[model samples]
Every structure is written in structure tokens, then in C-alpha cells.
Target: MARVDAAWYVTAGWALDLFQGRQTRDHDDIEIAVPAHGFPDVRRALSEFELYAIEDGLAHPLTPETLAISHQTWVREPATGLWRLDVLREPWDGNTWIFRRDSRIRLPRTRVIAYTEDGIPYAHPEIALLYKAKAVREKDEDDFAAVLPLLGPSRRNWLAKALTLVHPDHRWLEALRAGSTDTAAR
Candidate 1:
């Protein structure tokens, strides 16, 4: 966690929800991602809330000592102990975003994030779908189905290329290449 400030964009299923202008599915927790070096700024900005580091599926106090190793952090609502935020510290270069699992996959930050009409930033649905391709849970597949035809050809091509780099034999490649892209939906 560094002191520098950076943008934190909504990610995963919730990001798809934001893009669709509604909550499309029930999510275990909402997630956001910031450049890894900018996490301390997030901690300082959200200091009023309690934060914890997840270790082996357990929540531990998020302190300076744990910051280096904690790629993900949970913001817990004090009174209810209910977690409300999941923060992912992602690797980023000047104007470029790199996939943490495979640095070979990179994109301009502009293409990685898109904003809603109300100005909330979110990960592109195709990028979210790419992440989900790693482990296609029932919910992930549902999100894919919901967002597939909404993608433009460029978005579909980008995601298909990314999947090839990370998970060459990923099952979703077939569907992404199925020519379902609809420019009107984008």
C-alpha cells in the first residue's frame, strides 16, 4: 500500500450490473480494483470504515505489516461485521493495465474502464468476463450469457485474444467467437 492516489473501478459481476444500469445478480460482495501502489490512498480515504485482510478465508486486521502480502482487502461494516467491499490491488503501468495472473495480457487503461451515465467507473464487461473465464461458476456463466450479445465486435475480439494468452483452452472461447457481437448493444 503506497500513499499515491489512483482510480478504483468496480469489477467482476457488480461491474456488469453497473454497465447494465441495474443489479443483474446477487453478489457475495462488491469488488473494486486500484493500482497496487495506490492502495494506501484507498485506506486513508476510507479510514472511517474498518478494513481487514483475508488470509486463508479468514479475516485478519489490515495493518502496515500485512499490506505487502495482501492483494485483496475487505471493508467490514463495524456494527454488523458484514463485509461490504472487496478491494483488488492490481498491477498497472503508465496508462496500461496488466492482468495479474499473466503480465503478457495488457491494455490501455482507457479500454479497461468504462463509466456509467451517472459517472461511476466500472471494468468493461468483456474484461470482467475474461476474469470469470478462469473459473466458470454457475453465476459466472450466467453473467456471460447476460453480457455476451451486448459486446461490440472489438470487445469480443479483445476478450477472445486475452483468453488465448491466459487460458488457451478456456471453454468460453467458443462462445466469444460465435459472432454474437451486436454493435447496437454497445
Candidate 2:
């Protein structure tokens, strides 16, 4: 593992696995996000790894100015030619964390990141679900179902609110709302 001098957290489906303490399903790759500003440091730390920007599902070597835009990058070891992890750049600031896709959705930095007992940091369930909600795939749906039971009232409510803001007609809203009502009943 390379040392990165930046703030990063496990996000997306892998984050749910971290929260659940086990792998709920197969993941093609692991995703870790760094605050947009901190990526330069991460890039410096991972200088040994080949970096490719993923656009339209294809990987291209990053351009000199590509880092200015927010996107996911594929890290590979040039010597081994083996694809490695993904580094997602997210919108963040000193006090607040903003959803990269939706600026309207924001939360305090403290509310977005949670640490495991082992000190590994991961995105809160709501943050993970919000990202997954952008394009609801089968695995995304499964992740939501598996984590719904584990989410408490506040987390469910936060996800529900964020989904409504970013994806007003999202199918998951029905389940999220129902889950909240159910959580309150119990």
C-alpha cells in the first residue's frame, strides 16, 4: 500500500461493505475518494502507478490539465500492467462535503465520514447510497436492500431527503420513505 498525504475515504458499494463488516457481493473494483483539492497529494504519492481517466467507460491517459475536472481515474501498475483501484475525486471543503453530482446536497464533513473500529474511514451509508442512486443498477439495488435494515432513522431520512433532491422520481424513494416509516414504528 502506498502512503497518500491526503484525506480519503472509502465510498460507493465498498463503503457499504465497510459499514457491514463484510463483503455483501462481488465488486469489480474498489473505490476510494479524495477531496478534490487533496488529489494532487494523492497523485504525488501514487506517482509510481499509471493513471488513466475514465470517460464514457474507456480509459485514456490523463492529460496535463485533466485533473481540473472531477472524474474517476483508474490506477494501474505499469510494470505489471495490472489494473488496480479507482480514485474518485469528490467535492469537499474545510467544513462541508458536497455531492459531486448535485451541489444542492451538502452535509457537514463530520456527518459524511465514519471510521471503523480499526480506524479505516468510510463514507456514511447515506453518502454511499446517494452516489449509487445516480444510476441504480442491480447491485446498487441489492446494496440498498442489504443496508436498509442497518440504517437508523436519521440515516434513512437523510438518504430520503437527498434522493428526493437529486432524483425526485427515483424508484428508491418509495422504499426509503417506507423504510423510514417502518423504522419509526419499531
Candidate 3:
């Protein structure tokens, strides 16, 4: 059984380092986006460990307030050293900026795979990149930049499909494509 039953955007130290092709030395956290309905499962997954709350980024602002609910789950052993896992969940609505529950855009389970310590599933590369592209953070920019090249021709349809869902205005779309193109030319 999985922790959450909604679409999840999985990004963490491993994921970040993976996309960036670098080593992450710090005990960084993993971020996930989940629908409100999955809140109970998310709570159940992390109940055995410590919990912490963090504010959602302003660029990717949350509607209710500054602080977005999140929890940390971990177990440390003297010989095996400390094992830490952070899981953050917020509502996700594909049609707009914030999260709202809609069965229509709900992702299939197959699209998510085991990639992190918590056994939390992650959205496919295309879905992950779609969310990353909207982030516009420095690290996220780097991530988008890094992943786009590796995507090559395989991601053409994925890109088109995401555009239909997100429906970004022309200027932002051009900027994203231009950035991708400029990176490619280099």
C-alpha cells in the first residue's frame, strides 16, 4: 500500500542531484504534492516519526496561509547511522495554480514509481518536468535546464501534452521553449 492516493510531485535531494548530475552532501528534504483527499494516508505514512511544518514557496504560493503542512519520518540506528525521510504534501489541481480535487486529471498508479526512502511514489518524468518548469526557482531552472537536454526527441509529445493541461500563455511558453532551445544550442 502507498501513502497517498493522489497525484504526487516528487522532488528531493536524490531527485535534485539526479537531474542535476551532482552529489548532494546535505540532509536535504524531499517535496511532494498531493491532493487533500490523500491527507489521511500521508498522515498515516509519517505517524511513526517526527513532524515539521514549512511554508510553501511564494512563487508556488498556497491559498490558505504561509505555512503548508508537512511531516518528517525517520529511524536511526547506531550501526547503520541516521536515516531521514521528509514528506511534504499539498493540494494539487492541474487546471489552476493551487490544488483542488478532480477525478478527471487524476494520474494512474503506474505513472508513479518507487524512488525514495519512504517508498513514496513519484510522477513520471514528463509530469515531474511540467511542475518543475513552472517553479522558476534557481535550482528548479537548473533542473529544467538539465533535464530538457536529456529528454531529447523522446519528450516532444510529453511537452505538447503538458502544454495542453497547463495552458500557459504565449509569452511564458515562448520563454520556456527559448530557454530550452538556447540551452540546446550551447
Instruction: Please give the ranking of all candidate structures by TM-score, highest first, separated by commas.
Output: 2, 1, 3
Q: Give lDDT tens digits, candidate 1, residues 57-167.
A: 777798776766778899987888787889988999977999988998888999889999987889999878888888778788778878888888888889999999888
TM-score of each: 0.90, 0.91, 0.51
Worst ten in a row by lDDT for model 1: 177-186
Query: Stretches of candidate 1 above 4 Å error?
Result: 1-5, 181-186
User: Where does candidate 2 have its weakest 10-residue lDDT segment?
Assistant: 177-186
Q: Give the whole-model CA lDDT for all candidates, comma-separated.
A: 0.83, 0.83, 0.46
Which candidate comes out best when scored by TM-score?
2
Provide the lDDT at 114 for model 2: 93
Residues 1-186, model 3: lDDT tens digits: 265455544554345454445553453455555555565566566555443344342122222342343322222223544435444454444423231222334444454333545454554555555555554555554555555556644454545445556654422344345435343322
Candidate 2: which stretches are off by over 4 Å? Answer: 180-186
